[model samples]
Target: MTPDLIILADTIHTMDDPPLAGPEDSQHVQAVAISGGVIAAVGTRQDAGQWQEADTQVVDLGSATLTPGLVDGHIHPVFGLDLTIGADLSSASSLDEVLALLQAEGRHDDGWLRGWGLNPNAFGTVPLHRSVLDRVTGDQPAFIRLFDGHSALANSRALELAGIHGRLEFDQASEVVCDADGVPTGLLLEAAAMELVQRHIPQESFAQRKARLGELLRDFARSGLTGGHIMDHSEESADLFHALEAEGELPLRLRAAPWCMPGSDEESWKELARSIGTGGRRWSIEAIKLFVDGTVDNGTAWLYEPDVRGESTAPFWPRPEEYSAAVRYFASRGIPTATHAIGDAGVDHVLTALESLRHEVPADVLRRTVHRIEHIETVPDDLVARFQGSGVVASMQPTHCTHYSLADHTDNWSTRLGPERADRAWRCRDLRDAGVTLAIGSDWPIAPFEPLPIMADARLRRRSGKPDQHPIAPSQALTARQALEGYTSHAAKAAGLWDISGSITVGKRADFTAFELDPLTTSPDEFAASSVLGTFVDGQIQFMLERHA
Candidate 1:
């Protein structure tokens, strides 16, 4: 039989082993055959020739290392693109720079001026408030999101428009920062408070959302991503994705988890489960999302003890017992759940819920629908052991540790955790050694979407170059192979799509990320600086270096 395509590379990592554990490890392969968007064969160059025919369209990728397409375990595509339409404050180093950026944005004709990626570290010792933003925005109604997405700074005009008067009650500790006289300060913590101002901002029309998402997916392919586990989704997003799949070829695969809030009733949960539709061929909604707590920044994370600011530690659900009930409800039906749990207390609650549900869930179904705890920023050694055989996957982001935290344990996040818990930041090595499944991702918009730099950070425990950059718990660093697996096999397993994608095995989807250097042998410094030569999704070339020799 004539295969549709043949990809020839110098090396290929199948990710089917324990990552070069012994002298017998051999994951390198030379060629692969694709037929009907599935791998027909994978072996040495000579072995693959038996599956090829005269009409096979062979792609000679000279000296390139071909591996399974990278999978981002967690990301927010539509939301991230929506943020990009406004001023990008990610580069602003100081409060003055932030105001200058906002001032320039205010000059535009748009009714509401919006910006994203604001880092509070730029403020020095000064406290953030709406008054400062009002100086530049005036009556423009500016709302800027912090880099971590857990907090936002809104001008007084924007707050007035949203009608935020007093402190708001929420399942989590969302607060509308108040001054000495109990006046709103225009600083919103967590979604409950941020949404007050955010809801007033006009939403992107369905047409606009579809267009922007299409653009980002194409960019994702060029950056070597074949698929992503979208952390949050809506009915509109589901429809937009299916519409794109129906139109023609999609650049990448999408597996989205719809947002399931705490206050919704059981009937509502059942309705959401019923309304969930299957993706034509490239996308699907198979999981649900919940927030156990907010990020570690801004003192919103649910913790055993209060942060440096003495903020209350609370879960996102008004009644956490209800959260356990919800998990049980979904787990009984074989639906996987992904909870956003950053603090140890948050993770602890989720583990308890999973443990209670385990008794009722069948082992096979439980294994297939492994519930995940997202952004496990801090966990104790004892709690880490609970994940060993608990059928719970830890979905973590390496760049959160590298890009945001200082290795010296003096960064904002570290300072918030204090010395006692700061040392436990992103225990990737600890969890993996404890026999727990570790799935890594970029968390997109929160960090860069590229997998190479993320993998490098996982291995180095620090950013590339700059001798002054210290390693955060260097002992917790992952090996090059383990880091690669996080984005390949382990990620696919976390998403429950291991049967179809993830590795370069026969009978799997023909998705390949070709790089110029062998990732296994390359140093973290060099690998982080390398680029993708080409990307293939389901046997089709979505992106290739056109100018390359």
Candidate 2:
């Protein structure tokens, strides 16, 4: 068959073999021939002329570096649509600034005032309550989501709109956060609590959401992403994905996982199981996402011991044993899972649950299970050691460490866990050193989703832009190659799709990202600032810099 397209780059990091290996080691592979969305040939520059045909589209990324398409092991493009609505508070460093931005948005005449990406650190000594927000958004029903995505602060009007009068019980660890007088403080903790006010907020139109998603995915492609493992999937999410595909080809391929919440039962589990492999052309549901706990920053995370605030001692699931049963149900059937476990107790409970699967499931069935533990914000030495032979993928985000916390234990996440657990931080290098596959991602809307800057943060243990900042945990920093692998090879492993994706070998899918600088050879800082020349999915150019044309 005549090749559909051919791409030539100065260097191609196939990532199929050991470090520094490529398709043509003896002679740099100057050409990659693609036919029917798969790599047909990879050879020297001389072979490019022979592979060319009347219809072949050849793209020469002069002096650029080509590598396996970067995939975010975890992201929430669809859910983020709602979380990123209204004002963006990701840039505000102080509570004063947050209030000013919200006030500036002004009270919508018929709609609720909304904002997202509010950092908890901005609260400082002040408690996270709606009373402060009420000052700026009085009687307007304002709802602002914290940066963690696990909590929110609603103004009194919003709380009343949702009929949140006082403390309420939940199947999960979520709380209404009542004050000393048994009155709701407007601080909603976890998904269950946040949903109370969120459901009342005016949702955007489906057409609006679909358009936004398409634009977002194109931006993702321009940033060199060919695939993203969407961590959350709802019917609305599926609708959005299908609608985008109906209009045109999705810029990036997506593999999504629908959530299995605390109140779900056997029937719900079965329903989630049935969703597997269902999708449009470029998107599919391959796994189930569960949460063992919330986040440390909100004091909702299930830590081994209580945080300084005396919170975080409980698991998200009311019955921890039921969680293990759910895991076993999936594992025995060969279905994979990606669980969000942020605290030590949460991680331990998840690990212990997986460990029990060995005695319950047959060896062959167990061997086929590819379970992952996400966030892993803080874990003790013993829990970190458990992953070496456990076959559990560590799906972590470096920016969660570099962007959210501080070395001085001053950040909300660190201060909550206290010094001892804070010292553990995100042990990316330790997990890798312990023989665990550590997959990196942005957890977008929480952190910037650009792969290069995230990779740089993985190596620096601090943001690339702030060189003077002290590293959170220097020992946890990943090596240059390891950082790249986190987004490439290791990411595929996290999704159990390495055999078909992840690398540039012949016969594999022809998904690739071409960058102006070599990720492996360039310093992390320089690589983070570099530009993408092109990104391709299924052998089609999803995004190519206009300048390249």
Candidate 3:
């Protein structure tokens, strides 16, 4: 009767009920027994005694809390790995700091230097041109991405290397901003910026990429994450994931969604679908990703109104027809689609396409296909109701609300859509009230992929700082329990793996996260800094924080 593993704790936050519910109702027992990598029982200490025998390993997590392992519902793991090699300007708060960092790093002559996580807003204004960058970087080509990843700044030499000497061409929806003299500025918004950067960084070798992926996987495990949904993948990425699985090195559970090119032929998509099927013990392909538009920082997020500077609605990639066709094709094949749509207009276009497809496709086809609109940042009131009834999932990142200065955005939002529409930004509470399923994630490489930080933001509705800014509709803030669910059980459901993981019940995978401080009793700031004492996936200890005897 001895259990292979027994975990006992002072508190267990099942996240099974509302936060106000007393501990007894929300959780039970001091111990959880696991056998064959699945929860065998959840009951009192006395009950656990029945499962205990000579060989049983008792793990007494005294004074700590045990909860379901955190699942980062959305992220770009490949991109996360790439950051290790790229210039790390994420912590540079000001333009001067960024240049100083680059100067100290000393860029190579032929190598393309790239840095991510620079927020222009953090410095009060966008760094205007390559002149400042040129002064610091000398002749080396440098590309620095804004924290949001929607926009990027490139030095003159980098632009020249890409053959975009003084000016760059872009689609109607994209922009390559120029100075008053009509010369190309360092900044390029959305698709255009990505195009230039992509042309410069040559593809990394498979061996190098595999090593990077391994490092990232370990990092995720230490953060108490057991699974993640990779939003953007390529053929190379998919193959790498499979190779890792074969080698038993794919640390966390993976749901890879590769980018579906705009205007892809039917045969091509079908072939890609066949190549990437579902359910390996460690990896699966549950969705196809499409980029409908870009982020707000670069002023490229397709908005209902013009940008604050009086620019027209931002561009859409792949065009409406091509995007619609791709969605319909994926729908017909019974595969869910995740579209990156940040602005109101972008969300509207995606919904319109899905709505149109729903009518043409059979009822069964539509029901089987669960469409997701990523980053529903600015939704319309009417669309909120439609989204609720349409079975669309809102895969959102709450941390974005805190990271982007809402005060600056509020002024621009009100000017664009009037105060009435401004209330609809990241409506987590509204969507849940309307009976819509919410899946939360950290768009990593944009923000750190830690669930607690996101949970705190969702519950508090404000960041740790000076108040007086308009919080995103306080009524829309989720309770602590609801916020946890968004990142756990609900996130699993979004990725189509709810039944297999996400909960702490008998017959479920024994994946759990142990925290140094009980979240139930900890302060918001303490929760944000809480450490993961241990993480287990499929009853195997993936990470354990070193403790001194």
C-alpha lDDT of all candidate models, in order: 0.83, 0.89, 0.75
lDDT of 2 by residue, 354-382 (tens): 88889999999877668999999989899
Please give the ranking of all candidate structures by lDDT, highest first, separated by commas: 2, 1, 3
TM-score, one value per model: 0.96, 0.97, 0.90
Global lDDT of model 2: 0.89
| lDDT tens digits, residue span 1-549, model 1 | 469999988777777644443421334478888999999887778876787788899998978898899989998897676556577887887888988888777644558888888877777677888888878876788888888987899889998999888777765557898998888988898777888888888777777778888888988888889889988877677688777877777798888888778677799789767645465577788788888888777877888998888853877786888888878888887888999999999999999999987688777777667699999998888889889888799999999999888877767788888888889989999988887778889888988888888999999999875447889989899988889889898988898777887887779989989998878899988988888888998899999987534
Root-mean-square deviation of every model: 2.0, 1.5, 3.2
The TM-score between candidate 1 and the true structure equals: 0.96
Show how many residue pairs clash in every candidate, following the order shown: 0, 0, 1
Off by over 4 Å in 3: 17-24, 83-85, 122-127, 166-173, 180-182, 191-193, 202-205, 278-280, 408-423, 464-473
Q: What is the lDDT of residue 376 in candidate 3?
A: 84
Residues 295-413 of candidate 3 have per-residue lDDT tens digits of: 66566677787766665365466367878888888887788899998878888888888888767788987775678889988777887888867778889888777666464444333
Could you tell me which residue pairs clash in candidate 3? 173-315
